[model samples]
Target: MTTGLLIVQILNGLQFGILLFLVAAGLTLVFGVMDFINLAHGVQYMLGAYLAVTFVGLTGSFVLGLVLALAAALVFGLALEFLVFRHLYERDHLDQVLATFGLILLLNQGVKMIWGAAPLSVPLPAFLTGNVALMDGILYPTYRFALIGSGLAVGALLWFIVEKTRTGMLLRAGASNAPMVSALGVDIRKLFMIVFAFGTMLAGFAGAMAAPILSVEPGMGDTVLILAFVVIVIGGIGSIRGAFVAALIVGLVDTLGRSFMNDLLRLFMSAPSARATGAALSSMLIYLLMAVVLFVRPEGLLPARGRT
Candidate 1:
């Protein structure tokens, strides 16, 4: 591939990775700290996009809609935590899985009923609707750049919160040993509530940010949920740094593999065969990478201090 195309692909990969990080960051925290299996977290992402669509439409301002949607998502996530998830916390993992899985189905259908099955789109803010050239004959969407920048800013903010703040200290402690933290009078329930709410907001923010580029529709979060799981598995559950690094790795591997597999393979095989194999192999790249990483470091790259 030419240099320009390669640069474009790399940018695309970073953008995709950023989105994954946003979702995985929250997922890993909830899973790592609370030790809760929230199969329905993806639903939160889907809800965010849908909420953005609704709010943006009503307010006719992208910034206002995004703010409103995030507020709503936080409220809804807390409500779910209060009414449903909190009780499941004391139960076994099986019960948590089953309950959350059921919530996934319920919410997916609920969205379908509320928003219809048709896909929706959010208009890009005018300022971000243009494209910036990487070089001659290559250009990237300004919005995607904004997405990447915003995601990185969030990552930094998250790092500060988790690494430099009292709340983050508690989160790390909770992840390391929730029972012990509770024994020390940390109010484990309140901590769990905070973690859950924060995670839901992160996932929702990812969805809202992605709405301008990705199709907004029913069950949109399911695929992302799976990817986010894979990300945490690779990044080391409970480690924000791991999530951020692994996300970029997964994003680059998947994007580059898909974009160049066919071209690379065509040198050694028939065009049609190359295309077939490339498509299949590209799809498997991230999982294969995960397997390789796990084989090398069972705890994952940059696992939380206690974990590694």
Candidate 2:
């Protein structure tokens, strides 16, 4: 590939990384802070996409649809917290996992029942159409550029909140030591509600952003959820900073490897053998990266509470 195309791939990798970070950010915090393992988090992502589809159909505006979808997701998350997740806070991780797994099944089936098994999507606004040339003869989609911009904006906002705000301070404390924070007389229940709702909103936002680019369907979140888990594990569980860094690493590695692995392998083997081997090798690259991270830093690069 030429230098220009390589630059575009790098840009593509960055954009993809930002998108992954958006989805994984909340997943990391929910597990890190509440000490709750939520497998159904993926369902939140799916619901966000579906809600956007429905709202766009009704209101016929992307901005209005986003507002409505976020509102619905916030409500749904709060309801789940009140009805189901609150009880799990005091329970063991195993129990939390089982309950959330059940939720995944229910939510997936519920989505199909309501929206049907066929895929759906909301259209991007006309303003987001077309592409801009960044370099000689190279153009990239406007929506993708917007995605990178929005994701970075959100990440910056999140960083500022976590680093500077009182609520962020409490959230960090909660993630570090929930029991200690509760002992300090803060309403831990309320704090959990805030965290849960915010995290759910982020995941939903990711889903909505992705709907225009990716196919909107039931179980779409499953693959991305697993990738998010891998991101957390590689970055260091419960650390937003770690999640961000890890996500970028995974995104670049996965994306670049897929595009270049065959070429790299062909140096050592014939084209047919390189194609077969490269495909498998490229697929394993992220997991291999995770394995190396674990071997070196078993607790992850940034453990939420500095606990190891």
- Highest-TM-score candidate: 1
Clashes of each: 0, 0
Q: 1-308, model 2: which lDDT tens digit per residue?
A: 78877778888888878878988899998888888889988899999999999998899999899889999998998899989999898999899999999999999999999999999978987889899898879898899899989999999999999889998999899887889999999888888888889899999999888888888999998988988998999988889999999889988998999888999999999999999999999999999999998999998877676555
Residue 170 alpha-carbon offset, candidate 1, angstroms: 1.0
**Tens-digit lDDT string for candidate 1 (1-308):** 89988999999999999999999999999988988989899999999999999999999999999999999999999999989999998899999999999999999999999999999999999878989988777889999999999999999999999989999999998888889999999999999999999999999999999999999999899999999988888988888999999999999999999999999999999999999999999999999999998899888888887754
Model 2 TM-score?
0.97
The residue ranges of model 1 lying beyond 4 angstroms of the native Cα positions read: none
The lDDT, on a scale of 0 to 1, for candidate 2 is 0.89
Taking all chains together, each candidate's TM-score versus the true structure is 0.98, 0.97
